[model samples]
Target: MSSYFSSADLFRIAPLVVLSFGAFCLLLMEVFIKGAWDKARTAGLFTLVAFVSLYYYRGQFFEGSTAFQGLLFTDPYTFFFAALILIGTFITRLLSDERLREEGVGAQAEYFSLLLMCSVGAMIFVAARELIVLFLGLEIMSIALYCLCGSALWSTRSSESALKYFLLGSFSSAVMLFGMSLLYGLSGTLVIPDIASALSSMPAENMGILLVAIGLMLVGFGFKIGLVPFHFWAPDVYQGSPTPITAYMACVVKAAAVAAAIRVMTLLFVHGDLFSVWSDAIWFIAAITMTIGNLSALRQRSVKRMLAYSSIAHAGYMFVAFIAPETGGLSAILFYLVTYTAMTFGAFGITMIVANSFPEKTDADDISNFNGLGFTRPMLGVLMTIFMFSLAGLPPGLAGLLGKFYLFNAAVKANFISIAVIGVLNSAISCYYYLNVLVAMYFRKGEVSPSHPVGMPMAGALGVCAAASIFLGVFPSKLYEIAAYVVTTF
Candidate 1:
């Protein structure tokens, strides 16, 4: 045991150590400390912590090594996603501090601690090198998120979301495990690279089992990525969970899941014919997902549910990166994830702020509630406009437009011309709803009421989001290079 564990392993897992320490400290404050905290002071502290964390984990890095006896690995790929997951978590925490401060006893501690726990899990998830490690990492992430969804005990919808997520999430996990078990049986290996080595020259008789295994695993992954047909849970869960957590699910969890999927697809299914078979499946799924997602979003009245369907559409966009991995596809996906995070955080944060203007217990997220928001709250309206346009893949939303450029460019390079065309059509379809939000804010008239002022922490979070979206668009070459570097190690 002493020989198996080493200092290098410690370095490999340092992010988890740091996050676990944060969670433990927060838990200690909850148990040992007494009395309610000062809400403004608490929000300030959260903002400061997020600022400090950003100072350390602000950018992606490229590096590589094996850890935990090759059960887990450290690489530029993992580090890139680790940076993303932490940044998303910090911003979500800032929003949580502002939103949950007025809630009952222990809300702050539980919220912060569990978020840290979930980040740790997400880090483990993307760093996994073996199937069992992957399953364990995913379970850790999922269980923590289930608790986070219901952290708002005051809302029955929150409780319902948690229960729904747990039951369905468990089923998906089981489906993945069965697939993993079959893959192991066919290849006689749990290690991903070893399984890939075995699969490079698979016999015809074993191909059937291999296809079944791959299909099952993809089904499991579809739930996490919010791909259509498997995306039924997303709108309900995103709508019912606390708004900040909804954004977290949209950004952080989706990033982790996509990273994990990239690893599996890039490393495990290497046989030429087999890869083609699944790639074709992914192509069709992407088309249906993008079409169905945008069409469904067009009908939604609630902002959260609309964004939920939008998340599904984005998942389809993620699959476009999968269409041709040989031509810088993963890097395109990485860039899109980064920009999508910026746009989504700002959009959802503004939604929360605007909805707060209405009296409690009203249909706070109705698109109608956003009417006249531009005239009433000019700054928030401007921020939301930036996010919505970016989300719609329009200009001044340079981040989103460039991200899509990279994705569609990769598809064309790989000769998947038809799928690229479908994606463009879907983008046009999405503009209807994305721009509809802006139309509500700037053009429509509703009985607008006075809105609550944003807390310092939330404002800071939104500021970071808006700045990142614009900055990345203006200076994309360097970040795109960094993203390209990430997949080189793989």
Candidate 2:
């Protein structure tokens, strides 16, 4: 049999190629450059160009296609995730520029290149229609992140965080791969669609093999989303890594994994014999993840750690969307992801700004550093307030309110009313810590100076994220439409 590639498939996979090529070019540029040049400028420009190209190719999304002999598939679902990752890269790059300068690391060209590579991996992971491809894409993303986490050469905390992340991440990957192997052994194929089709008729075959595979996969996904039991690494890593990278991991990486999980559980599982067996476990995890995340966040003095815990809670919210039988849950999950991204990136952007002003002390993790911030830097205080309010699920910051509303609504329709109630209570508990920051900023007074200046690059990034949060909070219909379209396309 002669194998031929399709042009439509090529077009659908264009964004991944563009990002990979851009990263490659930047890597080569970093090698050739001499002495003390600003690599961030080069990297940022390349990232922006790549994202613009991706946006241009957005028109190609609705037409579904598969490539590499059906190893990867692209539809509106993939396009939505690809758009998110690219935009995430653009924002992270801008924020990283100043950090690189502060550390006296002359060329950030390589760092940005790695970020682009990571974005490519994340996009490909969501588009993967086959098991081998999924594993490969995940490793590509993980390796890049491992390196990025430790890139702050001057910070000892960065190195430690990287080590812990690497060890735990490697362990999770091993379990996931073993599960995939078992799944393949039982199904005689590694393609997701084929596996689903195979499972439909294999009543006598050991479902245990598939269960192990999915269970291990869940462990990996849980780690990525920072859910309960597997969430131990997030607080340390978030506090220790460079702030911008932490923000990137919190928003973009988590979103990609959740998006992929939505496909795997809802789309693939619905067609397989595994659905009945998996639903209970999913419900249990969702409940524990939400309760534990909210409870743990309440006592955190480190602002970054608190946010890390909150990210886990957000994952729990998205997790509940999976229990709904209909694909409406998917729309809710995707919309929540968009809102989460805006809120989180905005929060981290403010932290990044504060880091520049008090590099020796602020550290971006200390909650006390924020005391009387409203009196010192009014604009940053206001932006931080927006992030906090949005995160707390309050109005004018739609991330919390709208995200939780849709999630709970979907659960109610699915007849998981009790689950929805617990979810709402979890959201309410989450408000306490998120609002604590606001209290610190507005109510407390301190002796610190108010004259610290904000870096232009960092400020610009913060402004964009803040604006996105408020804009989406006010009129979320556009994003909901896009998310709904993506869910239906799959």
Candidate 3:
């Protein structure tokens, strides 16, 4: 037992330990803060510090390391994802500080602490090489999200959204665990690599185990990805949470989940020789999920709700790429994630500004609110338009064009021409609603009303998102290169 534990292994996993340690320190800081001003400043500062520390340790990725008998694998892939998760959490914390202050949210400190812990969970999730480690990572991420959903206790809608998400999420998690158990039972091992090797040895005999495990794992990740039938909680959760928190959940949380899903599928399904049978099912799911989400989004007046459904649609597009059969598919998915994250964050950041001032009641993000936004808030409207256009896959913006190109390129390479066709068609259909918001902003004329003004801190966050969107779109090659490097690590 003593031999199983060593300081050297601990150093290899220092990134996780550092994040956990940061969470603890932030908790203590929250408790001892002198006042609201001090509390907010301290919270933001702590998040920044943690992020820098994590980035510094990312250099270790070049060497790659694992610990605890290969339970956790800290390769370049893990480092890449860990960096993304940390940055996403840092932005969320910065966005949340001012909002929490204005709302006088109780336990704001706990909120930051949980956010840090959630980051820790997400970082470990990609590093997990063993089934038990993966399960624990999932729970850590889910538990923090559950609390975040209901954190605004005074709002009935918030409470309702949290309850529904908790119930459904817990059920999905149970199914995932059962699947893991079945796989372990059949393979007589809990490590994913071992399970993959075991599956290959008896492809005919292990059919039952493969089917059950694949189905269950799909249900689990499908919930996180917001695919059809599993996406009921997304709209409500997006509508209820504080806007910044909603943005975090939509972009960062969803992205990490998809990344983990890709790794799992590639290892256990594709490498295990199950991809041939399961590819069709994934294709069908992608078609339906994209179609349904786009159709549902067309009817939504609330921008948040529209984006919620749009996220589901985006997930489907990712699935389309997921089924592709090229090494570049991995790189393509990573590229899509990069563009998606920037555009989604920028869109939501603009929405947060609007909501902070207007405080939507019936429809916080209704298209009706944007009638004269072009004149009233020129920069915000323009930024929001850019986001919408990017989402629609239009030109000049990096997200729509290159993102689709990469996915389609991979699809063509894999002989998934028809799947690529449907994906493009979905993009075209999605453009209508995305453009509708722009029409409301620029072409239509109506009264503009403002309740509260946005602060510099919030503006800074929006600016950060906007710059990233354009920068990523303009020079996607750089990001693609990094993604390619990371994907090769596995």
Q: Write the per-residue lDDT of candidate 3 for residues 248-304, one digit (tens) a residue.
A: 888888888988888887888874356777788788888898999999999998888
lDDT for position 383 in model 2: 89
> Which tens-of-lDDT digit does each residue in 215-235 have in candidate 1?
889988888888878888899
- State which candidate, 1 or 3, has the greater lDDT: 1
Residue ranges of candidate 2 with Cα displaced over 4 Å: 1-7, 103-107, 271-273, 325-327, 362-364
Worst 10 residues of 2 by lDDT: 98-107
The candidates, ranked best first by TM-score, are 2, 3, 1
Between prediction 2 and prediction 3, which has the larger lDDT? Answer: 2
Q: Estimate, for each residue in 1-490, the C-alpha lDDT of model 2 and write its tens digit.
A: 6657766666777777777887888888767866666667766776677667667767766645566677877777887888888888888877786656553333377678888889888988899998888888888998999988888776788889989999998888888888778778777998988877777777665766667777888888788778788999998999888888899999999988887777765645654446667767778888999999999999999888888899988888888888885837879988889888988998987776665556667454577778888978888888898888888889777656888788889988988888889899998899899889989888998557535566787788888888887887678888889888778876
Instruction: Provide the lowest-lDDT 10-residue window in model 3.
Output: 97-106
Runs in model 3 lying further than 4 Å from the true structure: 5-8, 101-104, 325-327, 360-362
Best by lDDT: 1
Q: How does model 3 fare in lDDT?
A: 0.79
Q: For model 1, state the Cα shift of residue 294 in Å.
A: 0.2
For model 1, state the Cα shift of residue 120 in Å: 0.6
